[model samples]
Target: MGDASVVEKIYDLVVIGAGWYGLGSAKAYIQLHPNEKILVLEAENSCGGTWSKDRLYPGLKSNNLWGSYEFPDFPMEEKVYGVSEGQHIPAATLHRYLTDFAKNFGIFERTLFQTKVDSVEATANDEWALNVTSNTSTIQRIQTKKLIVATGLTSQPNMPSYPGEESFVPPFFHAKEFCNRADTVQTCKKATVVGAGKSAFDVAYAFATEGDAQVDLIIRPTGQGPVWICPPYVTPLKRKMEELLSTRALTFMSPCPWQGEDGFSMAHSFLHRTGVGRFIVNNFWNQISSEVVETHGYNDDPEVFKLKPWNSAMWTGSGVGIHNYQTNFFDLVKEGKIRVHLADIVKLDQNTIHLNNGEAFETEVLICATGWKKTSEGLKFKNFSSGLSYTTSDIKRLSKEADKKVHEMFPILKDQPVLRGPVKAEEPLRNYRFIVPSGAVFKRNIAYAGMVSTVCTSIFSTVQGLWISAFLDGKLQRAPKTEDEVTKEIMLHTQFEKWRYPCGYGASLPDFAFDSIPYVDLLVNDLGLKNHRKSSPILELLEAYKPKDYLGLGEEWVEAYGNQ
Candidate 1:
């Protein structure tokens, strides 16, 4: 606002996106460092990243419980499923909550709203050069000592291709556009939704409830892992049953679950997903029964999944899992409120959508909820985020593996050359917590400012865990405790697999995932009630975790020296 032509002062740290993760880093940083030069750049005038955006149809809400989505902090320590009868926070409400988080913490003061980061470049020095445009404003460059790429995956919708729909032109847009209400083209008598993912369901449900129109839903064979709106209370009980059934099934070599003859064990699933596979048992039950879309996968898998495009995993199997229809989404399809078309498109025309079976359906208005494609159309600006040039080799080096597809990983500088006078040796050890390589150590530097150089960042751990690690190094005192350093130490530990970050495999189940309990004997740990939380509800009968005492819930470092 001052001196339009003047370049803003360089910041100690430059944070992109003001969403949940973004706010986590900023607020945590401020907790320990009061006067750091930090600047938050948001494309929209507001702070909620995904929640603040995406209107799709109305009566919109989240499937995740309100308690599950609460920020990890004091004050709002109490949680509930306020809307979904004690289930999840709605999309609109989430947006407002995040907005409130920023206002209360005064984070907006550090923000340059209506600004979009178009590109970034690595300066001759290690600092980052960002080219950002404020709403309707000229492009401006801001230099900062550090850059936080907190823009989440949802920021980009994975749109798929459809036929002859481009010319329809009534009012076609992504789910993001529908959130605003005005984005609807013609809510014509027959509205056809092209995808069956969660967004597609939301789109279909919205049109039916808000537009009062019968909706036709088109689902790709693999896109249907539909979990419906079950009472959240039942989740725990149902989960236990499945686990016991899976354990017994796997032990006695009983028939595989999910009706698979492939004998696809959960072990194999974990192997493919970096040992961090989603709960397949849950996946089957949820998708076949639930309506929320869990994964927004690209048709081009290995290409998008691998770090170097070469380190891809094999596909197991996928198809529609909509067998439970007494009252499932398919029931809506059966009731004619929502029509179902099972054929894949063989052709596309201005007025007709042809499926592979050569069947053509004429429609009044088409809601190409056909989904968005993953393209480099407008988001190529990430190429400009730093000074050093990025290559496949660069990504591999940073990933500490042949692959560079980091989902829940914190980006860091791994395998960078360590000089030893004239000759460079494989970095002997990672020096600091933020700087640790997988299962290794190195020259230590706590000033997180220059310390985002770990081999692999944990993307799956508590978001607070990732947030605090980087925040401490970047803005806070830049100090790590013994345990913090040790755990991060193991991450950088030189022992290959031991040095590697934990994969999202079979471990996320109740017991395995929550194994690292923090002293709360009877408390809920993100996953809710501990013991029964492990296996499944069927196996565990009725249950409760009313922990009389919380154990190991607080680490020595986290309790005594965290973002207090």
Candidate 2:
């Protein structure tokens, strides 16, 4: 009787993409909710999702330290993680660690490798029709009550469409293509880098330090902020302690006893803006300014170039300025070792870049350092969507046309818990469809690595995507029984700026200090967190709360192997 309990090929939950968030949620959910029939589907062979694919980059390293960068359940191997040149662990080492974590957590057993998801459609029964396409000859259709999308934004690389882009006489490619440093060097001698973003800097730095390749990068106007004193991506504990004390003192001494904004505090604004992507930041960004640096294109935008208080929420990332790391790229350019052009790219002829400003560059290699876009247009989810398709036009059209406000196709009841400008007494339909949040409830299937919640913007493509599956398990919720209801939720959320997204802008940082309280006591005290969730949020509900013996430290887990 016990062996037949799980005979159904169909599952209660299906997690797409076995990446960091997917794996993390799998471990967490399995530990927290036993007996839940959950299976993870991965498209690639071998694990470590992104890391497994990018073994070509010879000396890749993370920007953050091994200590702060680790997941709560898994810590990096101490011997392999200690820094010599300021990085926590080598990319390859971290990849191995992730492999180990999966084994210990038992995530590998339920994963379907090399199996591509063909289609996912909802039935009249409120369940989902999931079509799985495998490299092998078998394609299976399974039913699941919930779906989790753990594929982060960088799943697809964005390639720019420059005129004559095809005319590039030399071979062209994105950073994702080159895995090893030797390949990076052999590809370009006088490399022309396009786009001045984090990836551009990362590519540049990789070429410079790892492969020793010289690069001439073309930079457009970065964000609109004053030249900040960007620092190196290194952490000196002494400096950190000083900054912490200063921040603490400033916080307490503020006129309103709140975390007030300070003038040109680079570190303060960095954590807010960098939350947009999956890349770990070096924190050196807050120490540099763009004024001293030079790049291609219009350096206009008074708002980004000008200084502002640290209103990370009000800025909506639009207020952000060019990060400090890119400015450092100029130092290489000014040495006449690498060149920078200010003209716009007009055309591309075989091996030559035509600029509108009467400039042309002949090249053997061209690197489009442009960032990736977050739409699923090219993705094969078409067959899987089962009639679910939301083009950018569809979202805009629905927002303009819808009169009645419904959450996920269900009619909003009286006294619906509407949030921001999502559900109104009048028109609804304005949210970005990727999220597909709650219809009439205050919450949605949204939450990131405990960072972004539904408040900022429910990132349907990242870890926040998994929360959607989590919500699906609880059919107990009354709102959102159909697809139309889901559409209504999207349209309604589009009314306000995305700063309201959980784990996005304006979302208060968690009080890492109060974690010392036991889960039972914390539930009773019921701080502001309780207003949004039960006791310690997911930690309390899932019984994953870490009991702390001191401020900001959980001694229980630390002492698990004590007495040695």
Candidate 3:
């Protein structure tokens, strides 16, 4: 822990979490206000939130390729990082790149690692009082004029409780802790993994290939089925998957309500509004889905066919994953090395797992690849003036109104996929532009980044960092000025997420895949900056947008609007 006097001092800005969003936000703010005192608090020992040293396990690779995963200002050079453009970046390489990004931008000097924020309250003096504790057991109070919560969605793991897990457990844990228990991959004879997400598949694959273990992958019959896993390349042209999703022309094919601002209002309307255009858009998505399914040979065996996604690629948000493994992941399953079970765990008893479908499995290790908790779970947020925590009412009424508006604006969203099982109801977040809470728009002292889930997180985090900095600096010309306007805006976006990504985390935060570019366009426009980064209209539509296109955005904003 630092000195007691240091904790007593107040700062111009304080950022929580040292991940991609936190580092990006701090760098952007400091660029605009060079002399301001800024501090970043991270719970982990090092940077790179999800890719931190504590989380990397064997066989873990990024869904993103080399070019699409890097920050715009600091390119991950092929020579420097030893990674090529088409290859999926390894976890170690990404961690090294993020650490270097922090050091290069001076964010490392401003950050305090292993400091966990216990609670945060709004002070009467219009500041934020953060009560934090370090790993050394030292507690202190730190205050800041502005706060940005960039903890993101992956901080806390969601470990479900089973009936007899306490007594029957033999090395049972969540996948996030795989780094610590990595020896289990080589030692375990048999392993059982729960859930069907990316993490589950990665864990099962590691056990099946790295060791002599027989892996059992359990996909709950009541939960969302297997996710759509696409190859690295797609389409008849064999374009990179991430590149295809990032291209404006391909993104425009998705029924996004905000794509009209791309200077193709007529084309957007014709594609999403007319019957013939809808057929073309639907056919495009269907073809992409069919190609992926056929490439994987899911139909070769009945058990392998069960791995096919329950929802269409168009309706599935971030649930769609990339097949970035070195070898064919399905080959092991076909060879009886990995078995898939479509049943829920009934109980665990002494290295045995009883299923709801009258089946019992004996395994030496049990790894739960279950998802994460809500981003706002750990910290307590309180409103300064009211002396009460912020809460929302009439969400149902607002959702109805917003749903009607979305259907009227984009009729294509009305045709939603039929979801299996009961989805746990999630309260829509009330943050304006998914950054500042609707009530805090006037305060402008608190904001959030990386709370929104998207495939193009590099671009989103960079643009969101600029938006939050400008809004905190009071330079945004298009921010909502009135409370009612901000509330309505937040409500509409929240409801649009519900309709756009019903199968993913849309109900809690902004979640999308291909629609990330248009979402960034909205933020760019709000900052009074040009959304188009390319020179020609043809290139702008066809060429994929990478971090390079958004390079030096903070400098551009300051140059255009002056760093007042």
Candidate 4:
């Protein structure tokens, strides 16, 4: 049954990737335009996207609190360790929440499971044509007036190529493959994890505590030396703030100028642009962080504390959030349950891995907690295994051809910088709001979701979906209007990312680098929602911001805007 048959269909809009972003995007768009023909194609068998079953590893927990991880409208009711009171929830709980969100919003019916998009190209009518293959190897051609790429980041594994590691006898794999391979992990006597990000730490902890394997955490030296590690910030005042803000609709509104778009409230523009607000906030952050660090024994070792890349305030602002360890990780290191090694792997022997610092360790399995490769590699389509003729489509090649045609059609957009080929992992994506091409191509047929990294995944994805939908519906008022403006904004934002975060993950894209809440407010305001503050100007200036209720914000907009 190798391409024995082909099916063709046309849709008003087609969304790729059935994860949280895709589902949320589809729901938001469809809610506004109920009559539109929509289709959602997912490579996996179910919804949840990144939170799907395959990515759920043992003892995996969110970096942020569950309250922030949940959608504004659909809150988690479970009393799990990390769910109810500003704690980290298990990966499984988050998956269940995502599944429920899709069902609650009626996004399941519009979705097609186990279908992979092979290619998407612009048609002559300014529409898009997609070549997709199903899990069963059935091929189809789909034409849609609009396309939404919701695959976001984390779709591909960013595997590191180590020298001489190919000769190792034990199994070596990325963290993404470790979920169902627990048995394999248990059999290993010694395991080594590369990198020091959240996933790297998670794998190391599991191997040491669960599998009882002697685990070595390999960390590379950055500008600040060792990576920063700290406990979650769940002070009573902060928890009270979250609770208070969550029920108020105004907290979701951003008063600041968003990505240089116009129409920002004068007060907000002054505070955010003049550096006055940040200075005040910074002082407050330092005080709270010092108190927390002292109270929790976090500063018992002055040398280790000084080596942190960021202070607690800066770390939270950098989107690093806080790591919620069930037990004190440092104590484990002290107990010798987990060993920390600071060196790069130079080479590997049959039974040992040699470090550049001249230390060598016998490794049975090497676990790479390294993040995924760039979005381009993950989004790049492959031909079906069945070797069907029409099933083959190259997304990058098609995008270039479409870009040329589109530019020829709109000559003014021709001068705009077009990403002619695959984007390298090291470079930041040139997307406005991290969801649409910031160039002057004037193309609304394609949009992106979930490309941004923020402290609040659920709320961020929700606002992104709403903003993208509003953009496609022409409800936005201050989008960058010229080629030069787009280019200027992109360069400025890129530099800001580097200046703010300086290195590792945060250095690439500063979507929500320091203040994710403010970023959300900006997106919300751009969606025609009024960013309201307290009646008293003094209170507005002094209030500490937190994630708040956005459910009413959208509803109020629907009532006021009438869905156009």
Candidate 5:
């Protein structure tokens, strides 16, 4: 709303969404291509993306440690987050960190706050035309050579409609909206939460433990796979185990390794395609899950509730990384303050929620902890000739087709145990190496940030931003040149996905929820940066990498590989 005057402006890069991903993307591009003009369009009034206004709910704390979750270039101010600074910070603290990061890195000045992009499509000249609407109701057209969708994963909230939900008298909304109005729940007598993710548990836990409201956590039988409950931080023993089975060592064991040859490689495809490799990775995670369950006294029974393979899919790791501070979650259930109902709601009346188990519950508030829509759907693009919307479904279909070609080429994988499951290609905005969609014919200039799910959200986003920038700057290589090659690569990744998270289909997107170290190494190595690991080889091979250990690595990489 700063200026109603609409003018056409051309930028070298137009980044949508001013959240963490957007900020990182803009920062990376500007740092590398200092002369290039980059504009970040955020719909919100302030920075921080999800960590900003959308997140200020009670009991909402980070799952990952702040030490690893912070921006590499800018360290978070000490004594601001967690008990001793650098632990699991609260949502408000994270919001501050993001805004602070933008200010420190000069990302705030180039960002267009309160600006929303309505649509982006490829023009005749291969450039992108973005129809933007500002908070002032003013419209503007932006033309850019490259468009980076940095909205991250949680852009659109998925609000599933129930039969009588529209007529419900009490407060009813998605978890995102509920967070926006969490204060109202303090007065409510009972709160009913639907879904089985971190949001669901957090909302239910907050209402039950903190407020006067009794909470009913309704987990649908047909919902996404079982949640693997675990503490947010990895213990000393777990960290040691991660080092022994590090990607560096695993890559050496692989017969087909990712060479420093191209923009992308099928090295991971080869590693995970084999049964032995799959067994080792899966077994390692199983051990971790067992340890977490034993340590926390969490339940994960194979006969009653099969734990989703942690190493299988992205974002499927220890389901909700709740902080250790919320230790009374299960205790609340035991004390009858929080009720865990493992059944779906059959119907909802004006004052009652009828479950599939024929049990009727009365609640004053109903919160849908249901997950968001596929992040790919947030990327609204159109096929230049067909005028059809480029959707997440299309991405899934393309990957499926790619997988088909791969199975045909590698018949041995056709009968592979990992390949036996139904292809879970439902989520959208599928990209090559979790960035740009290689299957799309037009607008190849667009790259997606934050599509992949990892334990360390900020670190993953930062690396993605740098990778996108390097790809745009023509410093790194791209995915395969041919469709067949891309298909083969995606097929192996899909198989890898299956082996890692067997129940990833329940996820909103195909989360690349793997260890952060190797993924970052892949990005940095592909970007042609020098080995950024500062630790000793023995330590690197023995311990899991954290953000604190790699502080300023991104800056170092930019200085070494930028505009190469």
Candidate 6:
């Protein structure tokens, strides 16, 4: 809402995307640099990236529980939000909380809604120039000394096309549009959902129970099969799944490169290095997988059995989901209300879809639950001097070397899973510690947040926010001094992710679940702060890490390194 003359004024910092990570970064920066002029640019009219108001549909809930999803500094109180412990937070509740967060932290006034950053380039004066467009078709240029991108990975929907689809049109759209097209579920007598991810399950359930319409779920034979859906409270102990996963002891079972940083070096070596320890670790994962299958009763019915996960749980990253519905979702399939098909759509005709398995289905509605694009395409980044993209040909050469080294260290990942199709090899994202680009670390003028996909997003975002503020303010004590060291560290970390989470999106992003705590520890140590938040070593090993555990981490960083 400002005039063209406003572009001449340079800002100290500019942040893109007003979602969870974006708001967190802005709040952290403002807390550290109180008087700096910082602005936040958001394309949506509102905040809450994935949980924005326009995106909320009926019966939608987060995979994470209430206690594990809030920021470290702000707790989602029961009296304020009406969400209690152990219950999955509704999409609306999360949106409200984020709206309140922005206002409380003074970020709402700094954010520019409906403004999209088209591209960004480095300037000769070691600053960033951004080309932005508003919803009213107003184009403008803005400059800032530092920039933080938090658009995340789910900004763009990945919709696939089938042959002859133009002829048959009965409300065909992606699942992300379900909120706007809610009438399709109420009016259609029958509907078909494509893909087998968490979104697919949610759509099928809504169609079957909410609308009482027959639903067909199609999972392509060539792609990864259904994901592992665990009950809210799993195992014989009946401990909350999110809490169990947050414990440091549970992460030791998973092979992670940085778990040893938590003062468990001996345990890490035994589990990943010794053959006997390997046997024990494998059995632990097998038992967990078996428990999920039995808990869901997948083997009782043939149609329900089709929902079993195709890969081992050890190889899974974010592919694992939580079953937070009020009723048993499998019961609907067992009753023959929601059908499951393991086939690919060959073509689409008028009110009909042909499958590669010599089958055809006629439906009045089609909803695609396919995943999102791997990276954000809205912003284009370029080098100031070279005028080239951040990604270069050297990535391929360095990645190959990193792969060999990772295989040597973790031999368990040597045997890779085989997908059916000719999968396109994507170049791994080259960012040191999954934040700054390796080539631009010395500049310290640009950073990324929420780029990695993890179940513990709140914890990761808060720690990352503090870390970014420290690095940009020249308060970090253990940062790499040379570009060569930064590049080497980035390549090795990316390669480890490739092997650690083979079935998920690890090839292009840092995707993890239980290992998030260790990842945060790495960042905390770099800021010259204590990684352990608990009072005793025993408690640190057994207790679950939550948002409250990290309360005052920003102040902790300030106490240790603020003066520098």
Per-residue C-alpha lDDT of model 3 across residues 1-564, encoded as one tens digit per residue: 222224434899999999999988988888888898888899898899999998999988899998899899999999999999688999998899999999998898888888889888988877899988886435488889999999988988999899998898689999999999999999998999998898999999999988869999999877778988889898779998888888999887877767766767888888888999888989988988889889998877887887988877887787678998878889888888999999989899998999998999899999999989866477776654321123445666777888899998788899888878887786766687888876578888988898888889899889999999999878896877677777677778888888888778777677878888888888899888889999999899999999899997887888889745
lDDT of 2 by residue, 1-564 (tens): 111223356786676767666776666556534577877777766556556655436445543333433454455646664534334356677667666776787777767777667666656555667777766425477677656655544556788678876556766777666563347565566566675544555566556655556665565422211212223321332222112211222222111101112222343233323443102222222221221121221133232222222222212221122233423544454455455554457788987877766777776667775654443332344223322257767755765554233222222111222233222122222222323333312233222232221211111122222233334333222335576766654444332222222212222211121111221122122111111122443433333122111121112212321122
Between candidates 2 and 3, the TM-score winner? 3
Q: In order, how many clashes per candidate?
A: 95, 47, 1, 4, 11, 0
lDDT of 5 by residue, 36-84 (tens): 7777788877788777776678888777654556776777657554444
Per-model TM-score, in order, reads 0.58, 0.60, 0.96, 0.79, 0.82, 0.96
Q: Between the candidate structures 1 and 6, which one is better when assessed by lDDT?
A: 6
TM-score of 2: 0.60
Which residue runs does candidate 2 get wrong by more than 4 Å?
Answer: 1-8, 55-59, 80-86, 180-182, 209-212, 221-229, 232-330, 378-436, 439-564
Model 6's number of clashes is 0
How large is the C-alpha RMSD of every model relative to the true structure?
A: 12.7, 11.8, 2.1, 8.8, 5.1, 2.2
What TM-score should be assigned to candidate 3? 0.96
- In candidate 4, clashing pairs total 4
lDDT ranking, high to low: 6, 3, 5, 4, 2, 1
Candidate 4 structure quality by residue, lDDT tens digits, 395-442: 234334444443332232222222222333454565666677653136
RMSD over all Cα atoms, model 5 = 5.1
Where in model 1 is the C-alpha error above 4 Å?
1-7, 53-57, 74-85, 136-139, 181-186, 222-231, 235-328, 368-462, 465-564
What digit string (tens of lDDT, one per residue) describes model 1 on residues 163-200? 66566544455566665643343356556677644566
Instruction: Report the candidate with higher lDDT, 1 versus 5.
Output: 5
> Which segments of candidate 4 are over 4 A away from where they belong?
1-8, 79-83, 222-227, 234-307, 310-321, 380-426, 439-441, 504-507, 533-548
What's the ranking of the predictions by TM-score, best on top? 3, 6, 5, 4, 2, 1
